[model samples]
Target: MGSNPTLSVFLNHMFQENSYEKIIQTAILTAYPRIFTDIPLSKEIFDELERIRKTESHGEITAELKVSKLAPELEARYKLVDQLLHKNNATQILEIAAGLSPRGVEWTKNPAIEYVEVELSEMARDKNKIFKALIETPPNLQLKEGNALNLKDLQKSITHFKKDRPIAVVNEGLLRYLNFDEKAIVAENVRALLKIFGGVWITPDITLQKLLQVQNKTTMPGKNQEIIQRTGRNIEKNSFKNEEEAEKFFNNLGFTVERHSLLEVIDKLTSSKKLNISQKEVKKMLEPAVVFVMKLEDSRA
Candidate 1:
């Protein structure tokens, strides 16, 4: 697992934090669809997930409970992206900083969707090993190693897809770690991809600190603060000051944006396990988490 220099520091921090374990939980739940979501989960992948989970103690059972609490929003975001792709007649999906996400496996089940998952080399290699051991490779799902900040690397990885066909790029777990300059590079790369592929960039990245504070107070008190303090990572510095600022910033970068709250899609969530907080309280806490869909203004016009 060779580290992409640009992401090594944060990736190292994430590894230390056992954040990748959270991703494993996602894969497990995603494979056992009934556990968290109705999305189709493959048994082959679930077997692999179980194998990996046995090897690590990711804190306590409480950690998995936390993941369960957050799973709905993440799964909901994937569903929303799929809906947007269908609406736009898009055929290709590019997932940046994909981590151990099972999206490539899940989305590729639809033969029409070409899925490209980009990860830093080490994770890419490790995940590839699991894919090889567990499931046969699907024709449409491709995994490639690259840095999000490098456009040339990004283009090279997804070159199999026709530039004329619309491509929806999904970004998760990338922005929260980046500083402003790194973020600009990422935006520039996405802008370049959209310029060539004619589609949208979807992410849950444009959060505001005020909303997070309110969310923490209302529901998962001290949890968000604990993450920041433990990781020594200031999430506020990485996000827009407010929703209005987020809009203006992206507009300046040539994207016309639409925002959706994670809370809006809470109705789709159905979990068998009881959450630490009630659904209503969870909704209140998630007020700060939002999904942003951005496309080139010219493309939309």
Candidate 2:
């Protein structure tokens, strides 16, 4: 338990009173609309997001300012998830720890896709109200109260979806908050889900301690520090020792894993004008990020 003065100082400044809920709030309410304007739901949710920001983080950084600072990195991560989702033909998506993300709201626009978003109790209740308020609520979209670590609740939550169709379980910004044991439990729960439906688990939640340590060595990597300190947790100790260990960890949990470089999609995003960040800047932000696509070995062809 040694202290790294660099990370400590940066964390204190950037994430003074942040938490997992606050981070999710920033992404869905702030970053989504501000950066990913091409998506229709992103534009539609602006007023609602403003209301949430006023109530959720009042007197803190305004949603616009916070998202502008986080725009490039956050948009890149979302693109990674969107890319991976398109890789599978699964018509059904079950997003865990869904927060207020507009993925379900947006994707349900296509009648073929059944998007189920699950969050813990209070968050689920609030989002349900908003989803209901929309003029055209997609019949295929659902918001439920479920915990990632609770197998029974997860099992019950997905009952509305067709039993025979495959399901892609998507999670982001959830695992880093969990300890090894908690992660393992979530893995088990996801494994069970795949066992039944036969699809993959898509996540960008895995982190490498080395990459973060490298970032901390630099003078102005406050974004990395904000991610770590927001949870009020020591992420270095929770993160994988290396990428190899991460693959092995999931492999032992019965997954056949594919690792995707989060930075690889930056060029596509920037070229499309969805991301205003430069290549040099995007490279720096992607230092500690990666996306993992986990399929049950048996599900693989």
Q: Quote the positional error of residue 281 for candidate 1 in Å.
A: 1.9
Checking candidate 2 for backbone clashes, the offending pairs are none
lDDT of 2 by residue, 107-135 (tens): 78799998888887767876766666654
User: What is the model-wide C-alpha lDDT for candidate 1?
Assistant: 0.66
Assess the local accuracy of residue 132 in candidate 1 as a C-alpha lDDT between 0 and 100: 88
For model 1, residues 1-301, the per-residue Cα lDDT tens digits are: 1112355644554456554333333333223433455655434554564565566543322342243454554555656655655666767889987765676887788898899988777567757877988778798999998777767779998999987788889886567656555566678789899999888898876767766676466534665555565445566577677888778777877889988787766666554233444776656656677778899988876
What candidate 2 gets wrong by more than 4 Å, as runs, is 1-39, 43-46, 52-67, 133-135, 210-230, 270-276
- The residue pairs found clashing in candidate 1 are 1-122
TM-scores, all candidates, are 0.77, 0.79
> What's the count of clashing pairs in each model shown?
1, 0
Residue 22's lDDT within candidate 1 is 31
Q: After superposition, which runs of candidate 1 have C-alpha atoms over 4 Å from their true positions?
A: 1-35, 42-50, 53-66, 218-220, 229-232, 272-277
- The numbered model that scores best in lDDT is 2
